[model samples]
Target: MKTAIIYMTKHGTTEKIAELLKSKLEPGQTQIFNLKKSKLIELDNYETIIIGGSIHVGSIPKKL
Candidate 1:
């Protein structure tokens, strides 16, 4: 199976988590992106998608 992980991080923590997940699930297929300068590929490119948005101060980033 193939997977794509999309992440938005305010701190390094969320990005680290995304890295871990990618390592276990997709390995070389993992692609890290920041909301400020990130692009989305077609969802059909991968069999699965894992979207991660950081929650800070009780709210999630709207950009995710």
Candidate 2:
């Protein structure tokens, strides 16, 4: 199955966790996207999707 993990990181913590999760999962079509840098992401392409972001003073990043 195709999977995608999209996240925003202010201090790299979220990026690290996304990498760890990707590594622990079984081998498959998995792609990680940094929302702050990604220009376009197609939600329909991935079967499984995960969205995450770091909180800054009780607020998550807007790009997330």
Candidate 3:
């Protein structure tokens, strides 16, 4: 199955978590995207889509 792991990190914590999660999944079947750097993400192509973000104060980033 194809998977997409999309995330946003404030201090790199979320990115590390995403990488860890990807490591447990099938090799070469998972891809990661950083919302702060990646402008365009095509979700339709992925069989499973995972969205992750870091919490700041009381909420996640607005860009998410």
- TM-score versus the correct structure, for each prediction: 0.77, 0.91, 0.95
**For candidate 3, which ten residues in a row score worst on lDDT?**
54-63
Candidate 1 Cα outliers beyond 4 Å, as residue runs: none
Clash counts for all predictions: 0, 0, 0
lDDT, residue 4, candidate 2: 95
| lDDT over C-alpha atoms for residue 19 of model 3 | 100
- What's model 2's TM-score? 0.91
lDDT of 3 at 51: 95
lDDT string for model 3 (1-64, tens) is 9999999998999999999999999999999999989999999999999999988888989999
Could you give candidate 1's per-residue lDDT for residues 1-64 as a string of tens digits?
A: 6677788887678789988887777456656565656765677877778888877889889888
Stretches off by above 4 angstroms in model 3 are none
Model 1 weakest lDDT span, ten residues long: 26-35
If the candidates were sorted by their TM-score against the true structure, best first, what order would they fall in?
A: 3, 2, 1
Clashing pairs in 2: none
lDDT of 2 by residue, 24-56 (tens): 766778899998889999989999998888888
Q: For model 1, what is the error of residue 13's alpha carbon versus the real structure, in angstroms, after optimal superposition?
A: 0.8
What lDDT does candidate 3 reach at residue 26? 96
Ranking by lDDT: 3, 2, 1
